[model samples]
Target: MKIWGYLSALTVAILFGVWFSLDKTLLGYLHPIVLASATYLIASCFLFIINFSPLKKKILKIINSKSKVEDFITKKEYGILFLTAIFGSVIAPAIYLNGLNRITAVNAALLANVEILFIILIGVFFLKEHVKRKDIVGFVFLLIGAIFLSTNNLQNIHFDASLFGSILVIVSCFFWSMDTSLSKFLSHKSNIIYITALKCAIGGLILLLISISLGLSFSLPLDKLPLLLFIGLVCLSISLPLIYFAIRIIGSTRTGSIFALSSLFGAITAFLVLGEPLTVTQLSFGVLMIIGVYILYMGDNDQNV
Candidate 1:
């Protein structure tokens, strides 16, 4: 991975951190599924508009000529795309939403850092990606920092010790991690804009139908539309594409390590915007996380991930 890859991952952390903080207000008023469905629908619509030209050209090319266009998507790619929708769009988010319902959004975001561990495992062992000594050392620092951040500087090393909700959040992280790893398979095989648009479309439609079938209302007051648009257009639409681009270039494991900063960013955002307190210990741990990421990429310019 180059600097852009790392930068993209870092941006995702910041975006999700801020989004989760803002999302707290909405979660207080709406069912998680209903909210997710609406935001995803908006994201899909926005992405489709961006993908429209290439989408039409590809369809026409396939029908009108035998020669492949640069952005042509294959059946195997579509299969992987659908799997990502299932894991990323539906299963992981649904489970995380339920877990988030039981705990604070900050805690839920912190718990999701466990996805880094799963990503590294799958990327290294399953995908056969290489690991350097510094990467391991940096990952150790990130992991420890994440632990400290979540546990309040070892005050709750057990991580909310006995909360089943916490466990649920971590479990959901694993599924999302799988989706992250699976996403790497799509990097060079298809045009991400179209693929991601379709992903959000499939996932959003499924979630919408499920929400309606469960008698959850899609209606929202005018006052709420602005925030909803921000969640969908910026958080969902923008963030998903950036993460995919980073993973495409950097590979999942390295991208995930940087993305783990979401926990620290979330805590700070909550403290600043939501009046949640940020203790000195958490700040210190957050510094360690920065150091970890810096060390993780110390020699990245020398070689690509």
Candidate 2:
């Protein structure tokens, strides 16, 4: 089961890696806020279908769940979900997208690593989640690999943008980290679909409202609808569910650490999907990240308690 948890995290890394590439591509069609709002809203709708579907009872039996989505989550969980949605699905994406527009991929990847660090700190200090000695060592390995990959082994350095963009990325990462830690509260719950749906609904609606107030263009090209659907239905819907499930079994700290590889994986996917060059240095450090994850998995000492 623990190994399965590890695999689920790995799968999330891949799925989100794909999402990052797709997200970058879709920005040409819609405003960042609009794209984000659409993706999250669509994801929420998909989850809503599952939650209230006629087959919901059968699905419950499959997962051995007793509670229905309508009443399973408590008010406390609702509060946590609302906060997480604001930090992650709302603020983080908007800031991260704007930041991405300013900085090079190199700087973004390096700074984005703060997400996992924040997660670990919150998980250990605030959440009181325990990790083994092996966890520390593995995290070191993972961080080292991430650094090398992010900097491209220090081969070609570029600081094209001012520090403002970098700061935005870091700030956005902080909010995302907050979301990861807060969502840990729901990791023990049975209704992942409800958790994801409500979070997305709240986040998406808020973003939509912000866009409306700012009078941002919501003109989505019809040609872009397929990719839009894919992003919302596949990335947010599928990826987030997998993330919540993995968090349930593995804890948010480790899961966030492993999921951090998504950027490294994104580099690889960009090469494949966008016809970008794949450097040998990148391939090397990418493998190192994988090794680090394996080491981390070797030390799943506590099941988030």
Candidate 3:
């Protein structure tokens, strides 16, 4: 991968970390569905504006022939892309926000890393991607770290700590993993900006309807306006576009692994912002997780060699 690509991917991960922490703060003031709807709406608008710009039009034309665009983007493609939007942008954020409300931001952040494991599993089994023995070993370390992170009150496991929220996050992860894989396949045939915009617009519309039906409030205080905009621009607009670029540049498996670092950043941010307590176990597990990630990455390098 290019150095710029890796840096961009890392940047996305860090922004995602900050986004999760800020999302918790935002959730205190707004419903997750409403927040998601607004963010996606903002993202969609941004994508639409960019897609229609002369610069992007030229780039899009160069990347895809007009005939290819028409042929590649069938109803089947739209259907798949819409489902991707539903799972990734709509359901995932809703679950994550709900879980964030129920648990500490640190715990929620760490648990969200489970998506890496899910992605790897889906890639290996369903997608028929190669998986080395070391990858499996790395996954074990990640699982161990997750256990340490999840055990907030070691003496008392909180099963009631948003089981529904957790399930939603997991399902969201599954959808996102599938989306990532599908995006990679689709990129060969179509413009990524078009695919991304479609997902955001369709997904945002769905969530908007749900938010309205659920009677979620959309009111925002003047003081909270800046944070909401920051979240919308930085987290939703910037980070998501970067994620798409990262997926295109690095491929999903590597992107997924690198993205796993978001958990570590989230943990540190939670400690600083939320004053969440950090135990020795969590710290040690974090180190192990990093080492495992390094090992897995090295294995990937070896295969390429």
Maximum-TM-score candidate? 3
Model 3 C-alpha lDDT per residue in residues 48-156, reported as the tens digit of each score: 7877887676755644442233335777777777777877878777777776777777666666677777777887788777878888898898777666555642543
User: Which lDDT value does model 1 have at 152?
Assistant: 52
The Cα local distance difference test for each model comes to 0.73, 0.72, 0.71
C-alpha TM-score for every candidate = 0.81, 0.82, 0.86
Q: Tens digits of per-residue lDDT for model 1 on 95-184?
A: 777677776666666666677767766767887766789878877976786565455556654545435566676777788888888887
Clashing pairs in 2: none
Q: Candidate 3 — worst ten consecutive residues by lDDT sum?
A: 62-71
Best by lDDT: 1
Candidate 1 deviant stretches above 4 angstroms: 53-70, 130-162, 285-304
lDDT of 2 at 101: 62
lDDT of 1: 0.73
Error of 1 at 287 (Å): 4.6
Model 2 residue 137 CA deviation (Å) reads 5.9
